[model samples]
Target: MTVRDLSALFLDSTDRPLPRAARELASAGVPVFPVAPRDKVPLIRHGRGFRDATTNLAQVDTWWRRFPQANIGVPTGAASGLVVVDVDVHGTNGYDALNRADRAGLIAGWEFLVRSPTGGLHLYYPAEPGAEQRSWQAGNAGIDFRGDGGYIVAPPSLRVIDGETVPYRITELATEPARPLDAGRLRGFLDPPRPPRRLPTQMRGQGRTGPMKLANWLGGESTDRNRKLFWASCVLAEEGVPYRDALEAMLTVEQRDFGSREIARTVASGYKRIHGDPRLAGKNSASGAGTARAVVDAAPEDRLASARGL
Candidate 1:
C-alpha cells in the first residue's frame, strides 16, 4: 500500500480508532499527523470578525446557524487527514534528511491549528532510506515527533463512513510508500518564508490595544473603513495628533477633490439644517446625527490646520 492509499483510508473513515490508525501507518513506514480532542475551545469563523466556540458556545451555534446556508455548495467545518515525510536513502540516511530542525519547521508551518487553541496533535517522522517526504501544510494539523518511543497521535473521532473499525497497528499503515519531495518543484512552498525576527511595527495594536478599541466604539465590531478609520486615528494619536484632529484629517482627504464648492456647500447646508436642530437627540436618528457631527466637526478642524501650516 502507498501513502495515498493510507490517506484514502484516513479520509474514508469518520469514526475510526485513531491509535489503531497510527500503528497501522507506522507499520507501513508512513508518518502520521495526529490531533487530540479539545473541549470548550473556540473556532474562528472565516471572513468574519466573530469567533466561534466561546464559553456559552455562542460562536459555535452562530457558525452552525450560518454554516449550512453559507456552505451550500462548498465544504464547511474542519477536515481530518495525515502527512507523510520520506527521505532519499541513496544520498543521505533517513534520520539525517529530517532532523529536529526539519521537524520544527513542519510544526511551524501548521502552527495555526495549535494556536487555534483547538485540541490537535502533531506527529514527526524521520526520513527513511529509499523514501521521499511529502510537504503539505494548509488546512491541516501536524503531530509532534520529539522524544524517544513517542507514538503518532490520532483523533478518536476519526472514522469511516460505514464505521468499520481501523486497527491501531502502526506497522500496517506505516508500510505505505513515501511520496517524493522535489526541491525544484516545491519552490513555491518556500516563497513565503518566515521572518527571522519579528519587527516592533508588526507587534503594534494587534491584540487588546487595537481591535478591542474599535469593537467597543461601534457598539458591535466596526466594519472595513470604519475600523480602519478608527485605527488610523489611533495610530495618529499615538504619533501626537489629537483624536479630533486625526478624524478631521480623514474627512479632509475625503472632500479635497470635490468638483464643485457650491454643491459641497449646499450639501453641508442641508445637513446643518436638519442636524443643527437639537430635537433629534435621544431618538431613532440620533446615532446617524452624531456620526455626521463627528465628521463635520473633524473636517473643518483638519482643513484649518492644513491652511495654517501652508
Candidate 2:
C-alpha cells in the first residue's frame, strides 16, 4: 500500500506516538501487542506474548491507555500473515549477504520492509493462510526468519543506545494487500544446501572472528558491560590477535575516536588470560561454556576492571 493509504488509516496521534501507532496498526487488521516504550520487552505483564496480540479496538485502546508509551509488537510467521526475512546489518557481513540474496532472487514478490534499529532490515511478506510456519535460522547466512514464536517491533519505535536513538521505519509498503508467503519461496530461503567441508583459510585462522567478537561487546547493552568486555577479550586473545590490533578494531567498529590505552589493555586481558594459560594457549581447552568460565576465573581483576579507561 502507498504511504498515504497507510497513513490514512492512522488517526493523528501527535500527543502519544507509540499509542497512536499501535492503534493505527491494529485498525489496519494487524494484531498488535504493547512492548515497553522504546524497547522490545513487553509492557503488559503476565503470560502475554505475541500470541496475545489483538486487533480489537477496545482491547487495543485499553492497552495503550494503560501504557500510553508502549511500543508496538506484531507476531511474525503465519499467524499474522507475515514472514520476516531478517537481514542483520551488523556483523557477519549482513549487508553484503543481503545484497547477494536479493541478486539471487531469494527475496522478491513482497513489499513490506522494516529497517531494524540495529542497522538490520526486517523484510516482511504475507504468509499463506493456515500455513504453520515457525521461526528458524539460516546458519550463518546472516538472515533469520521471524515466523512462529517471533515478533517485530512496529515502526515509530525508537531504539536508544549510548544516548543515541534509532527509529525503525517501514521502507517498503505493500501496494496491494499482502498475500500469504509462498512455501516454495520460503524453502528456497531457509534450506539452502550445505557446502562441502573445506579447510580453514589464512583469513579464517587470523581474521574476522576477533573483530566480530569485539564488535559484539561494543554493541552490547548488558549491565555487566565489564564482563562482556572480558569475555570478548578472551575470545580475541585466543584468536592470536595482538592486543593493540584488537583494541583498534573494536574501537573502529564502535566508532570511538580516542580513549586511554587501558581500554585495549583491559580487553586484551581476555586474550592474555587465554594465551597465558597453558591449556587454552595450547588450544587444547574444551570448546564451549566450561572452558569459557575457566578462562574468566583465571583472569586477573586488574585486567577485567570496567572503569580502567573511558
Candidate 3:
C-alpha cells in the first residue's frame, strides 16, 4: 500500500476500537501482530516478534479474538513500507536534539506524526525503495530510528504508565508532499565522526620502545579511539608487558571516554591477538625487550570490524 493510504488509514481509525482498527489495517494490506494490552511486547506464542506479522485477514481475526484487548504492533521498514524517527523525552530531551537536526534539514519528510504514550514523538516516513535502512539508537541524544528489524506500536495502542492507561495517538498528517528521512545523514549529524589520530613517525617500527610514550600519546586521542587503544595494547603485549600494566595504562588514558569493561575487552583482544591467548607477563620480564615480532598489518576499518563495539 502507498504511504498516503497508510496515513489515511491511521488518521481515520485513531479513535476506533482496538480490534476493529487492527483488522482494518490488515485489510488494507498492512501486516500487523498482537501486542500485550497496555504494553509493547508481542503476544504471539513462539513467534519471532515482527517477522510473524501478517496481512491475512483470517489470522488477524483469530489473533484479536484470542486477545481482545491486545495492542496493535506494526513492523517498520520494508515489511510495512515505512520507517520512523522516534524522539524520546525521558532522559535527554530528544526534542532538543531533534530541533538541532531539523535546523540542519535532516529531520524533514515525515508523512505522519504520532504522539507516544510517554510524551515522545514518532515521525513516520516512507521506506526508500531498494535501500535497507537499519535501526539504530543514539542514546545520548535520546532519539532512535526504527527501520529494518524494528517494530512500532501503532496509534490507539495503550500503554500503562504510573497506574494509568494511555493511548498512542495520531497527532498530525502531512498536507503537503512527503519524503523519506535520510537516516544516515541524521545519524552523522547527531554523532559526527572524529578524525583519526596518527601515530608519530618515531613510534612506527620502533618495535615496542617507549610504551609510556604510547600511553601519553593515546591519552590525547579521541578518534577511532578504541582501535588505537587496541594497537597500543598489542605493542605492549609484544614487549612482554604484563596484562595488569597494560590494563592500567589503557584505563588511565580512556577511563573518561569508555567504560571499564570496554577498555578491558579491547586490551584483552589486542593481547590475545598477539599471544594466541592473553598471559600476564612476569615482573622480571623486560618491558620493551621485544621477542620475534608479530605483524599488525590490518587497516583501521578491518581492525575496527574485528573489535567488538568499537
Candidate 4:
C-alpha cells in the first residue's frame, strides 16, 4: 500500500521462495499473478495479461500450486503503486544512457534498484496517484519505462539467462525519502522534439536547379529515404547552396517515418562532411557548379561512401 510496506517486503523476501513471496506481497495489498517458470509470460491462459492480476490470496495459492515454479509478477503503475525504468545491456548501452539521464536529474527519485538476470537494472519508483504513465521504449538508448498496462517480474524470481538460472536480486534501496518519477519529462529528454523547419523560398533565381525540384525528388523516395536525403544534401552542398536554403528545401519533403529532427540531422551531417561546418555554405557557387563536379571527381571514394549513407 505504501513505499514502507514494499521496502519491508523486499528486505524480508530476499531469502524466501517465490510462492511465499507472492503471498506476502498480496497480503500487503499488492496484487500479483503467476508468470511462467523462469520466464516473464503470464501462466494464466485465456486471460488478459496484467489485467488479470488480483489481490485474492486463494487465486494466488491455486495458480502457484498448479505451477510450483511459477515466477512472481507485479503489475506496475497505479495497480501496484509502482513503475520501473528498465536499463538493458544486451544490444544497446542502456547504462550509459541511464547515467546521462541521472546526471540530468531526469531519472532521479528511484526507490530501489534490482539487478536483472542479464546484468541490466530495474529502477523502481512510486507512480503518481490519479495519473496514467503509459509504457514506452527508447530502443536506441537501451532503456524502457514500464508503467500502466505493464507488468514486472518480481524479485526472488528466476530467469534462464545463457543456459543458467539467475535470480532477480535487490542491490540497493534509497537512503533518503523517495519521490515519484516524472515519466513525461524523462520521455521528452530521451526523445526531444525538433523545432519547425524554415519554409523553402519560392524564388528560383539563385541556383541553376530550383529547391522545389529537389524537394519533389526527395518526396518521391519510397525506399532508403535517409540515404537518399543525405546524398542529395551532399550534392546540394557541393553546388555551393547555403545550408539554410538546403535545409528549407529538404523540410518541404513529406515522407512517413522521417521526422523533422532526423531529416535535419542527416542534412547537417552531409553539409558538415562537405563544408567542414554546418553553418557555412557555398553561396558564391551559383556559377561554380563545375567546381563541385571537379571535387566529386577527385574524391570518388568519399562520394561512394556518401551514397551508401555513411
Candidate 5:
C-alpha cells in the first residue's frame, strides 16, 4: 500500500515528512517551527523563542524548503496553547503512573495522544491564558509535562531513541490538539504536596555567578560541552532553577564554543531526563550522579538507550 494508506507504520523519512507534517499541524492553527532534521534540535529560537512559531502557509513552505531535513517542532505552551502529558516508555513507570493518574481522574480530560518512537506517549491539551504551568518532573514516575516554556517534537520527524530510529506518530490521529486537562486538577495530581526544594541562590534572579559556576563546573571542551551542558542543565532543573536563569547561566559558558541553539536543545533534553530513576544518578561518575548523567546525557542520543543511558 501507499505511505498514506491504512496501517502504514513509521513516518521516518516519508517523502516530504517535514512539509507534510507542517502543513497538517498549521492547517489546524497550531504554531509550528523547524528543528534539526533527524534530531529534535530547534532551528529558529531567537527574537520570539518558540513564540516565533507560525501557521503562515508561506513561512511554513519556506522553512521546509530551507531546511528540508529539519524535524517539526510544536512549542508546548502559549505559543500553541498546548500542554502535553509525556508518559515515557523507557520502562513501565510511565505506564503505571498513567494508570494511577487515570484511576484518580487525572488523565480523563485528555483529548489527543501520540505514540513516540521510543514507545512513550504524548497526551495533548489546549492551554489556558496566563497558565502558571512550568515544565518539571511529574510527581509520578516516568511522567512529565510540557507546559509554559515547554515544547514537544511533532510528528513526521525521525526520533532516534537509543540506536533505533522511529517516527513520532499519532496512535489515534486528530486534526488538532484537544481541549486541555483541568490545570488545577492536573497540578493537584502531579505536583508534590510538600514544599519544593529551595531554588538555587542564583536562580532567585540575584546572582550572576550561577552561569559562571555552571560553566566552570562543566569545563571547556567542545567535544564534552554539549553532554556536560545537557546534564548540568538537568541538575539545574532538578534544583528548581528558573528557566531564564538557567539559560543565562548555561549561555555564559556556551559562549566559548557551543551555539545557543545547542544550549537550547540540550536544556530541553536535560529537563526531560530529570524524571528518570534517582538511583541511576552516578552510573558513570567518580564524583557521582550529576557528573555521570552529564557524560551519558551528552553522548549521542542513540547511546542514551543503554542501561546507563540518560
Candidate 6:
C-alpha cells in the first residue's frame, strides 16, 4: 500500500493541503496519518527557568520524584496528540466554525480523550470526499494537519504508516474508514495509573506539607476584604485558573476593601479571563456576609494583618 492509502486509514476526508508525497502515497493506496512538519510542533525548552519536560511516561515519573515538594493532584508531564477536522464540506477557510464543531463534539462525545496525561489534543476528519487537499489546522496555535488523504498531529519523534512505524511526515490520503480498536486493548497500551507516591522524609522538610494541609491555613480570623479575596482565589484555583492572574485578581479584590460592586467587577474579570464567566463563580450576596465575617474572625492574626494592608 502507498502513503495515500495510509492517510485514508487514519484521517477522515475533511483535512486539506496534502503534501505531494502524501497524495502520491494515497494514490498508491497507502494508509497514513499525515502529521505536520518537524519544526511545526511547539517545543518547550528545558533547564533552570523552564518547567522540566516530560515527553513520555518515564520522564513524567522522574520529574515527580525530583519535585516531591510539588503538588501531584494534576499531571506533571504533557502529552501530545491530534485533532482531525472535516474541511471539505465545511470549507477549509471556515476553520473557526470547524474548530467550534470539533471542540463541541470532543467534549460531548469523548470525555475520555480529555483524561490523557499529554496536553496535546488531535482533531481528525476527512480530506475531500474525492480529490486531495494539502493541509489543515487542528485548532489554535501552530498545529497543522498535513497529507493528501488526511492529516495527523504527533510528537516530533513518532510517525505512522501502513501499520509500520517509520520516519515519514504526516499527510493526507484516501481509504476506507479506520476500524474501531478494542478499548481494552488500547487501555493496555497506556501507562498504568499508580497510587500517589510519598516523598522521602528528607525531602518532606518543614515547608513540605501537602497542598491539602496548606489549605487549612485559610482558616481563622481575617478581614471581610481578605475573606472575600481568599474565597475568590480558592474558587479560581479550583477551576484551574492560571496562578499569576488568579493572584492579581485576588489582590485586586482585597485592595478594594470588598465593596460589593468592586468585588463583583474583580470576580467578573477573573471569570471572563479564566473560567469564561463571572456568574459561574457562584452568586455572592448579603446572605453570606455573616458566614464571611465568621471566617475572617477565625483566621490567624498575621494572615488577617496581611490581608488588611498591615
Q: Model-by-model lDDT, in order?
A: 0.28, 0.57, 0.73, 0.72, 0.59, 0.29
Q: Higher-TM-score candidate among 2 and 3?
A: 3
lDDT (Cα, tens digit) per residue for candidate 1, span 210-259: 42243233233223322233334434344443333433334443322221
TM-score of 4: 0.63
Q: Once all C-alphas are superposed, what RMSD does model 6 give against the true structure?
A: 23.3
Give me candidate 1's TM-score against the actual structure.
0.20
Encode model 3's per-residue lDDT on 1-310: one tens digit a residue: 9887887887778679899999999999999999999988999769797889999999999999999999999999889999998878898877778766665556666776677878777888899876667788888898999998999999778998888888787665565466777675566557643333645665677564555777787877777666577778777778788878888877777554355665676677567557845253332123211210010122322422332221
How well does each candidate superpose onto the true structure, as a TM-score?
0.20, 0.54, 0.64, 0.63, 0.52, 0.19
**Which clashing pairs does model 3 show?**
none
lDDT of 5 by residue, 152-242 (tens): 8876678777888887765543332233454434443454333225433444555533545776665545554554576576667777776
- Lowest summed lDDT over 10 consecutive residues: which window, candidate 6? 107-116
lDDT of candidate model 3 versus the reference? 0.73
Q: How far does residue 81 in candidate 1 sit from its true spot (Å)?
A: 15
Candidate 5 — what's its lDDT?
Answer: 0.59
Worst 10 residues of 2 by lDDT: 287-296
Off by over 4 Å in 4: 194-310
| Candidate 2 Cα misplacement greater than 4 A, ranges | 1-16, 173-310
Runs off by more than 4 Å, candidate 6: 1-99, 103-118, 136-143, 147-310
Please give the lDDT score at residue 228 for candidate 2: 50
User: What does the lDDT come to for candidate 4?
Assistant: 0.72
Point to the candidate with the largest lDDT.
3
Residue pairs of candidate 2 with colliding backbone atoms? 1-174, 1-175, 77-147, 126-181, 127-180, 127-181, 128-180, 128-181, 234-270, 237-271
Residue pairs in collision within model 4:
none
Cα-based RMSD of candidate 3: 18.3
Please give, for residues 252-277, the per-residue lDDT of candidate 2 as tens digits: 43323223333453464465456553
Q: Per model, how many backbone clashes are there?
A: 37, 10, 0, 0, 6, 59
